[model samples]
Target: MIAVLFAILTAFSNGSASVLQRRAALEVPHTDAVGMSLIGHLLRQKVWLAGIGLVIVAAVCQAVALATGPISVVQPIFVIELPATLLLAGFMMRAPLPRPVWLGVAAVTLGLALGMASAAPGGGSSAVHGAAWVPALILTGLVETLLIAGGLATRGNVRAALLATAAACAYALTAALMKDAMARLDGGGGAGALFTSWQLYATAAAGVGALFLLQNALQAGTLVAVQPCLTLGDALISVLYGVTLFGEDLRTGWWVLPELLALGLIAAGCVELARSPLASGNATAPARARRVD
Candidate 1:
């Protein structure tokens, strides 16, 4: 329960950061998108800096959640980030959310609750066992490589979806690595062991890689193309990692029905929310423009 609370807090923080950063990004010239000039411009924006600060806070909350709960449980809760972001954007912009947006939010909330209750993910080890990491890392790398290559070969929405999928995989891998590193501390290995673990460094690398892929995805296509893939892919892949690598137990057989239904609802909600102007980076557009075709 404590882990779930922290995960929710993390989602809220990340959602708020996304809205703030998007607002700040809109102030910069589009010509600056490709280089360090973009970062230089953003560094001058207080809104962007606040977003970065929230991102750091989210990371701390995520670390705490992973340390206390199964990765399967902690990571899936991030599916709410989209809904949270839309709601936050609406509140910040003083725009009343449309009916579909509210429905989407309800769907996501209910689906997440139903899924957690039905799946009951538990019995995972805090730390991964030896030799298990070898095959997992190799397979993950191969999958991400294929996704990135496919994304590079494509254009438009196809490129965005593929790149977002790659980013999702990297984010999931980062969470798994973070959990393993945090486990070292729980196991009485101390700060020395935590810093020395390869997983710690790998976590940082994977997180940065994920951020890069996500940025490329955003540039390639609309949120309709990237958001659902990013949200659902991360949750599902993280669950796979938890089950395979961390030995997290989830209900199977008859219980799979509700789990599948929950996933469907979550996916539908994500798609609906992603289509909204609030979630698609158009929250600041003129009301007349929003009302037009």
Candidate 2:
């Protein structure tokens, strides 16, 4: 339960960070498609720096959650980040969330509750094997490579979706490695050993990759499309990593039906939320245009 609480805190931090960072990123002057200069520009923004601080907090909370609970348990809880982000963004944008948006929020909340209760994921190993890292790293690298390539080949929403998916995959890999690193921290290995762990380095690298992809995604298209794919992809991929790498077990048999139904509800709700005027940028267009004009 404590782990769950920490995970919830992580979700809140992540959602708030996303909104803040996106706002900052949008304020940046248009630049090259993908370059360090773009990142340098964002780094100078106070709002973006604040968002990075929240990201650090979120990472610490996530590490604590992974240390104390099954990765499956901790990761699935990130699904809440979507609704949290929407709520925070709605307030910042000063747009009244429509009735459908409220309904979508309810559906997502109920679905996550029902799904988690039905699935009951538990039992996982943090003692990662050398062989385990090989396949996981290779697969994650290949998939993210493909996603970046595909995203670069496209434009508009398609590019955003691909980049966001890549970012989600990178984040999932980071979390998986982070679980191992955090587990080491709890084993009385001392700070030196923790710093020397390969998992820690891998986690940092993956996190950087995820951040790069995320910025590009935000620049590519509207948040309406990018945010949902990022949210859902991260949650689903994290579950996959938890089960595959951590030896976690998800409920099966008759329980699969309800889990599927719950997932459907989440999907539907996310779609509805993504279509909101606020999300699509229509709600704030007049004000933005006036500022530009």
Taking all chains together, each candidate's TM-score versus the true structure is 0.91, 0.82
Clashing pairs in 1: none
Per-candidate RMSD, Å: 4.6, 5.5
- Superposed Cα deviation of residue 240, candidate 2 (Å): 1.4
Best by TM-score: 1
- In model 2, the number of clashes is 0
Worst 10-residue lDDT window for candidate 2 reads 284-293
Model 1 regions more than 4 Å off:
26-41, 285-293
Please name the candidate that would achieve the greatest lDDT relative to the true structure.
1
All models: lDDT? 0.85, 0.78
Candidate 2 regions with alpha-carbon error over 4 angstroms: 18-52, 89-95, 280-293
